[model samples]
Target: MPTGRALEDARSMLLETGRRILAAEGTGGLTSRSVTDRAGVAKGVLHRHFADFDAYLAALVTDDAARIRSIEPRSAGSTVDAVTDVVEQVFTPTTRALVALVISRDEVRRRVRSPGSYGIPLLMDATAVVMDVLAAGREVGWIRRDADVAALALALIGSAHLLYAGELGAFPDHSATHEVVESILVGSL
Candidate 1:
């Protein structure tokens, strides 16, 4: 029955609570009841905003994907550094869990995935961001002109995801992220 700002706050509260649950306990701990309890909202509030839990999850993943797309790769240093920055931004605990949630649930994956697009939701968007960085590097002579940016982007994203996704709650440090980026781009640059 909240009106105006309270109504908006209710949805934001639900989403934020869901994200915290995902970060702390992964997708296994997230449920409609859990979200409602954590957000201090009634169960019907979630249903009122979203069709079901899957739809709410889709919104969450989609919201995160948009964030990934908005990240502007750092261009101040080496191409590796730029790519590393973007990877770091994309590989946070919440994002990592969102990626897992997308992979673990078939319906949520389908709902978040764009038509005709193939790849995991958040990771795929991160790859595109890295590809843009690599393309810029190529343009500026930092990367080899003949390098296959698509493959390189994929390699970087997949390898970094493995490195970051290996441990939940604890993210890899900058050195580890740099190592992954440098190793993948060593030959291409």
Candidate 2:
């Protein structure tokens, strides 16, 4: 039990370290030694927490996803409010990594192909909020009665990626981002 707990604790620490490295030094700074140094753990401790570097990176992404979810407000009143919450939450390290993953052509291919990446609940929670809000909107007749809620949820999530995806290509200005999100919500409603 002690060993298992330690491994779990180390995994959490490494993920936290990964976020700090990304913020402080960008993606290139995410070395195992850096993670150990940031985590204040010995090198082998990081290794013991995961199979290898790829495992660590994947875990970092997962951890950031959780961090993103933590910032999502429970009952945002409006679609714009929801969008604001998402944008603010994603500005964090995990959100940056997620944006990075989708923007980079190579990482995009890998993430889209790998279903496991979405297995983390953090990303899913964002989607869940969309669903929840839409469901509430439906109850109040603020959304379409015959709407495809899941599809709308997916669309909202996709728009978030487009607005926040700094890695894919140069994005338009804030007006573009706001218009895109508002357009999606309007379409659904």
Candidate 3:
């Protein structure tokens, strides 16, 4: 049996591989062979750490999601710099990757069923943080107060999904979406 340190090393390598594959390519590039190749580890290493690609991906998604969730919720500043900071910092690469996985039927199902950190509670927790951010923004008079929090959250998630979609990825619609969200919140307030 490998020592704890050895196991951690292997897991780290696998995670690195997963992140690289997903970032440079996309979900399609994630495979045992690809991960092992990228990680420079033996195929057995992956099998030891994960049941299969589905299992490995689920764990990866969870690990990365957790890291991203570390970004604390705060009032979004209106300045371009402030908004950019939240976007780039809070929505870190891992968060984007996790969101990509969430919108995918296959990935989300695997994550839900998998025995890992990316469970329903985790998803809901992340959603709650986002909802809170929106609510706080509205309460502070930065967003329209009357905005339907639930629907706004849904719209935000949808916009994130649509932004990452293949064909329609090029539509400069986030500004519009943001405006709508802010408008709704401000209007409600």
Per residue, candidate 1 scores C-alpha lDDT tens digits across 1-189 of: 754234557777899999899888887789999999888778999999899999999989989999999998655588999999999989877899899889889999999889999998999999999899999999999989999999999999999988988656788889999998999999988
- Residues 1-189 of candidate 3: C-alpha lDDT, one tens digit per residue: 874334557887788878877766666666789998777767888888887767877777667556645655343465222222333343434445555665575654555544654434334445445566667666776657676766655555454434434431233344654554454344444
Instruction: Report lDDT (Cα) of residue 15, candidate 2.
Output: 80
Cα TM-score of candidate 3:
0.67
Report the error of model 2 at residue 106, Å.
9.3
lDDT of 1 at 187: 98
lDDT of each: 0.89, 0.63, 0.57
List of clashing residue pairs for candidate 2: 103-167, 103-168
lDDT sort, best first: 1, 2, 3
Candidate no. 2 TM-score: 0.67
Error of 3 at 126 (Å): 5.2
> Each model's TM-score?
0.94, 0.67, 0.67
Off by over 4 Å in 1: 1-8
What is the lDDT for 128 in model 1? 93
